[model samples]
Target chain A: MNLFLDALAWIVAPERFEGSSSLFVRLGEHLYFTAFSVLIATVIAVPIGYLIGHTGRGRELAVGLSGAARALPSFGLILLLVLVMGVTNKPAAAFTAFVVLAIPSILAGAYAGFEAIERRTINAARAVGMTEWQILWRVEVPLGLPLLIGGIRSAALQVVATATLAAYIGLGGLGYYIFRGLPLGRYDEMLGASILVAVLAIVIDAALALCQRLFVPRGVAAGRTPSLRTAPARRRAMVETSTAP
Target chain B: MNWVLDNLDLIGRLSLEHLRLSITPILAGLLIAIPLGWLAHRYRLARGALLTSAGLLYTIPSLALFVIIPPILGISYLSELNVTIALTLFVIAIMARSVADALDSVDGNVRQSAVAVGYGALRRFFTVDLPLAGPVILSGLRVAAASTVSLVTVGILIGVESLGYLFTNGYQRRIVEEIFSGVVMVMLVALLIDLALVALGRLAMPWARRPGRAAR
Candidate 1:
C-alpha cells in the first residue's frame, strides 16, 4: 500500500542514515541494549540456575517465581525505577528493568538444561569415580547446553521486544521512531521503524534456531545419548548387538 | 494514599475497561483458534505452514504491532479497536499452536474408540477429542491469559483506554501511588483471571484432578 511504500522511502532517505540519531545509530542502540541486558541476566541467573539444577533444590520454587515474575509489568517497573532513582539517570533505571525482564527465561532454561540430563548418566559418572566438579563440567554442562541456548534465545527475544518499549524513557533504539513519531504524527517513520525491528527479530530468531540445530553434537542430533562404556566394552556390545544412533 | 483513594472511581472504571480489552481478545482468540487448530492437527501438510506463521506472528513485539496494525486495518491509529484487534492477533497466534498441540495430545486409543463406536467425525471431535485435550489447552490458555493481561497495559502507549492509562498518566504527573496502584491492580486482575481459569478447568475436567499429577 501507499503507506508501506512511503515507509520504505522514509527508511532509505539518505539523510536518515547520516546523523548521530540516524537509522544505524538507533539500530545499534537497540542491539546494544538487548545484548547488554541479556548478558547481565545470564551471568546473574545462570549460576543460580545451574546451582539449583545440579543440587536438585528449589526448582519448583524457581519455576513458580519465574512464572509469577512475568506478570510484573515492565512498563510500570521502568517508570517506577526512573522516578525513584532520578529521571536524570534513565539508562540505569531502564537497564535494571531489562535485566529483570531477561532473568526468568534464562533461569528457566539454565535449570531445565541440567534437569534434562538423565540420572543414569550421573550415576554412571559417579560410579566411574568422577569428582563433583568433573562430573559437572564433563557430564552435566555438555548435556545441558541445547536447553541453555534455547533459554538464551527466548531471553534475547524478550529483551529485544522490551528494549523497543524502553525508548519511552528517552533512550535511543528502534522503538524511538515509533514512540517519538507518535506525537508528531510521523506514521511513515513509525511504520518503517516497526517493520525494520520486526525483520531484525525474525532474522535473529532464525539465526538462533540455526545455532540450536548446529550446536548439538551429532549423536544428540541423531537422538542417542553417548554411552559411558569404555571403548572395549562398547566394541564388545557392538559385536554382541548393533546399537546405532 | 489519598490520591489513590480520591481516584478510586477512576481506578474502578479503568480496571473494568482493562478487563474487557484483555479478556475479549483471549476468548475471541480461543474461539477462532479451535477450528484453525483442528485443521492444523487433522492435516499434516497444514501443520508446518500454520505453526511457522504463528511463531513468526508472535515474534513481533506488542508495541510495534500496535503501530503497524492501524494502517493495515484502515482504522484510526489511536482507536481502541486497533489495540483489541492486535491483541486478538497475538492471542490467536499463541493459542492456535497450543490448540493444535492440545488436540495432538489427545489419546489415540480414545479417538479410535470413538470412531469404532460409530460417533460421527464432528460429534467425536466435540465430545471426545476436545474434552480429552482440555487440560493441555487450559494450561496454554493460562499462559496466554497472564501475558495478555500484562500486554494490555502497553496499549496505553498508543492511547488505548486501559489500566495502562494510569501508568502513563501517573508517570507524567510523577504520582508514584498512582503508578504503583496500576501495577498492583493489573497483577490482581491477572491472578483472579488465572485462578478462575484453573477453577473452570477443574470443574469441567474433573477426571484431570488427580492428586499425584504435578504438571504445573
Candidate 2:
C-alpha cells in the first residue's frame, strides 16, 4: 500500500538523520534511558535477590511483591510521579518510573538464577572449605551468569518497550514521532517511528540471546543451545506460578 | 480522602469501563489461543514458527501498537475497538506460548496411556490433556490477566476512556487526589481479578486441592 511505502520512505529520508529529533538522536535517548534504568534496577534488584536466594528466606515474599509490582500500571505510575514532582523535573520523574518497571524482571532474574543453582553443587563447594562469600561469588555467580544476563535482557526489553512513554511526558525517544504524528494525522511518521522501535527491540533481544549463549557455563551451554532463549520466559513463568502466598 | 469520596461515582464508572476494556481481551485471546496452542503442540513443524512469531509480536512497544493499530485495521483512532483488538493481540502473544508450554508440561506417559486406552484424539484432549494442563494454563492466564489490567491504562494516552483517564485528567488539572485514586483503584482491581482467577482455578481443578500430594 502507499501508506507502507510512504512510511518506509519517511524512515530512509535524509532529514530523519539530522536535527534534535533525528532518528539517531532519538535512538540514543531511548538507549540511554533503557540502559540507565536497567543499571539502576540491576544494582538494586540483583543484590536483594542474591541475598534472598543465598539465605533461602523470603523468596515467596520477594516473588509475590515483584508480581504485584509488575501489575502496577506504568502509565499511571509515570503520570502520578509527574504530578507529584510538579512536571518541572520531567526526566527525573520518568527515570524513577522506568526504574520501577525495570526492577521486577531483574529481581526475578537474580533470584531465579540463584534458585537454579544446584544444592549439591553448593554443598560440594562448602565441603571443599569455601567460605560463604567465596561460595556465593565463586560457585553461584559464574554458574548463574546466563540467567542473570537473561534477566537483564528481559529488563532491557521491557524498558525499551516502555520508554516510549518518556515521550508522553515531553522527553525524547522514538515514541515522540508516534505520539506527535497521531495528533497531526501524519501516519507515515508514526509508522516509521514504530518500525524503528520494533527493529531496535528485536536487535537487542537477539543480541542478548547471543550473550546468554556465549556467557553460560560451558557444561550447561553444551547441549542446551536451543532452549537458551527461553531462559527468561521460563523464569518468568516460575515467578508467576510461585505467587500463591 | 474527601475528594475520593466526592468522586466515587465517576471512579466507579471508569473502573467498570477499565474492566470491560481489559477483561474482554483475555477472553478473546483464550478463545483463539486454545486452538493455535494445541496446533503448535500437536505438530513438530509448526512449533518453532508459531512460538517465534508470538515472541516477536510481543516485543513491539505497547504505545507503538496502539498508534499503528487503527491505521492498520482501517478503524477510527478514537474507537474503543482499537484498544480491544490491540490488547487482544498482546494476550494472544503471551497466552499462546504459555498454552503450548503448559501442554508440553503434561506428562508424556500420561498422554500415551490415554491414547492406548482407545480414547479418540478430540476426546483425549478435553478429558485427559486439558485437565492435566489446567494448573499451568491457569497460571499463564493469571499473568496475562494482570498484564492486561495494567496495559488497559495505556488506552488513556490514545484518548480512550478508562481509569487511566483519571490519571491524565488529574495530572492536567493538578488534582493529586484523582491521580492517587486512579493508581490505587487500578492496583485493587488487578489484585481482585488475580484472586478471583486463582479461586476459579482451584474450584475447577479439584485434584489440585489435595493436601496429600505434598507428602511426596
* Per-residue alpha-carbon lDDT of candidate 1 for residues B1-216, written as tens digits (9 for 90 to 100): 999999999999999998888889989988988999988887767888988998898899888888788888899878888888888888889988999988877766667777778989899999998998888898888888888998999998878888988889988999989989999999888888888889988999999999999535
What is the Cα-based lDDT of residue B78 in candidate 2? 72
Clashing pairs in 2: none
True contacts kept of 2: 0.55
**Residue-wise lDDT of candidate 1 within A185-220, one digit each (tens)?**
999999999999898888888888888877776767
Count the clashes in each prediction: 0, 0
- lDDT (C-alpha, whole model) for all candidates: 0.86, 0.84
What docking tier does model 1 reach?
Answer: acceptable
Candidate 1 interface CA RMSD, Å: 7.8
A8-80: candidate 2 lDDT, tens digit per residue: 9999999998888899999999999998998998999999989988888998788788779868988888888
Q: How high is each candidate's interface RMSD, in Å?
A: 7.8, 7.4
Q: Which candidate has the top score in lDDT? A: 1
DockQ of each: 0.34, 0.46
- For B1-216, candidate 2 gives per-residue lDDT tens digits of 888999999999999999888789989998888888887876656778888888888878787787667777888767789989988999999988888878877776677677778889799999998888788888888888888898899888778899999988987888889989998889888888888888887788988777754201
